[model samples]
Target: MDRPGLADFLRRRRELLRPTDVGVAEGPRRRTPGLRREEVAMLAGVSTDHYTRLEQSRGSAPSESVVAALARALRCTVDERDHLFHLAGLSPPPRRAARHVSPGLLGVAGRLVDVPVAICSDISEVVWTNTLFSALMGDVGTRPGRASNITWRWFTEPGVRDRAPEEERDRLAAAHVSDLRATYSRRAGDSDVTELVDDLLQRSREFRVLWERHEVAVRRSDHKTFVHPEVGAVELRCEVLLTPEADIKLLAYFPLEGTDAARKLDVLRVIGTQTFATA
Candidate 1:
């Protein structure tokens, strides 16, 4: 790894960002111009000492996951993220998988403090989320590996459907299956697409049946009811906005006009991505 280069890059990027830019509250007594090392560590899911050592140019090479997390925490652009990877002596993530969210998109998501917001990968994996979304629908941090895949969870994990109204469950499952089919078509022969499909087919008889029908459609706009543990039932319309390259999708859940969702979301915003098990 280019230790000095990486250290310089990390420090410079961290220095350029303010607390509010990443949805953090600034302290009245705080005199530091940018985010502290501890705050960056907290945001990047790393230890303060670890981030500190890296910034001091003495740490070992960071794993791919760590680098990616740092890029997101630093709100690096696509090119910047790639440069970071190179400086860390690692290859950048493939655009086909598109796990790295854009800086502009991240900026938008950060400002959406009152609403339930989440960013998903092209393959339906939850890559990032704002606070309210976690409060409403469990935290993205809790969903590791295949658990992070919405379609995989919907099919393989029972009781996940309990969040949605019972009547809409079947249609929702079919809709997600259709969305996966659309992705499968676009990313044909891709290992990321194939493995997820193959695994789901093997694990879920329900998924198998739906995959056979070959449905194709992306869920752009939809109404979903989330039976929140703390907030009760909330009816919201999920609007999907694609990033410029259409590699990632941002899902914003807005309260329906007649629903009590606004108040519920405000409460959830206070709850702030603290997660719990539904079952």
Candidate 2:
């Protein structure tokens, strides 16, 4: 690994970004040229000391997860992200269809403060989520391994389906199954997709029935009702923004204007973040 080069690249990238670019406040006193080390560490999901050591060229090689997080935090382009991986003595992710979130998309997600936003992979795995999303969806990032996937949770975990309305549960389950089918067609031999499908077919009769239908449907704009324990029921319009590669999608939830859902969302924002059981 080129330690000095990596340190230089990281420092330069950090200096290029401003507070406003990443949805952070500038504050009153203006001394620093760009975002602070702590701010980047927070955005990248790493310890401040670790990031500092990397900048100082005194840290060990970062893992793929940390490199990906740093790429997102630095808002690096595809080429820059690849360069970061190479500098850390790791192979860059394949250029073909894969499940990875883009740095630009991550930057966009960070800018959305009022709404609950999450980035999901092609197979419906929750790659990243903002704070509001954690409050609404029970901290999906904390789920174990494949459980972080929506389809996996919907089939294997009973509590996950409990959040949706009873009347709509069947339809939601069908939709999730159909979406997984679409992904399975694109990523036929992928281990994650294959294992998830096999596990679901073994564990869930409902999923097995839906999978047999061979339904293929992409997600679109729709209204979803979620039952939050603290805020009760909230109905929000779900919108999806696909990245250029089409492997990652940004899912944002917005409450209708002048509605009780909007008020409930406000209550959630005021409540801040809280821990909830993960499936």
Candidate 3:
């Protein structure tokens, strides 16, 4: 995966970035030229040994913050930061990538039920989720093919109507895809990413066509509505949170203020629990 080359490249890149470029003064007798290992390490707030290990590709993975510090030390651009992360097997910080899910993260998703909560990692893989989220979408998790992914399901599956009737479905689907696209742009070469695109192209003409437009979107604010067969219509506000370390997105769905969506959600929770117990 170019780990060694990437590490070497990063190290050389850092060394090549002179103090002048980073707005630091060039000290006397720079024998090797470029910033000293000590200088780069100091700026990155890491031990010289650690930085050396990273350059040699002989170290454990670095934290996102540490990587960010290193990126700054090397004067990496945004694309470079993301590329560095990809080489290191990390998602870019909560801003541009999807992250793996942990128990604590699942707990947060479970607790925040007034909204649908799902966690996706880089390349739009659905790693973990809460019950209310699955229930609202009407067996989305059980659907064939890419239906397991919100973006995939929305764009590539024919099951949207079962989850939400016409008008509401399109809005939610569009917003979700837009958010997914924003994340995808930073790491376009991930294999799963290519698979998703291929599947969509082959399975859904709409996604195939939209894929051509190359419209990118970030997970900004959006309004979503779902017409649940059991709960009638529900309107929600969407918020996306990027997790530290892994660029995972925590997407939450909140009901519109003072809406009956709250009670509907309660019912969904009960239903979800029952379903889980049975399965």
RMSD of model 3 against the true structure: 14.2
Root-mean-square deviation of candidate 1: 2.5
TM-score of each: 0.92, 0.88, 0.55
Ranking by TM-score: 1, 2, 3
Best by lDDT: 1
lDDT comparison, 2 vs 3, better candidate: 2
lDDT of 1 by residue, 93-139 (tens): 88542678777888998888778888898788888877678777886
The digit string of per-residue lDDT tens for model 3 on 92-114 reads 76444342244345456646645
lDDT, ranked from best to worst: 1, 2, 3
RMSD of each: 2.5, 3.3, 14.2
What lDDT does each candidate get? 0.86, 0.83, 0.66
- Regions of candidate 2 where Cα sits further than 4 Å from its true position: 96-100, 142-144, 190-192, 256-258, 275-279
Steric clashes per prediction? 0, 0, 7
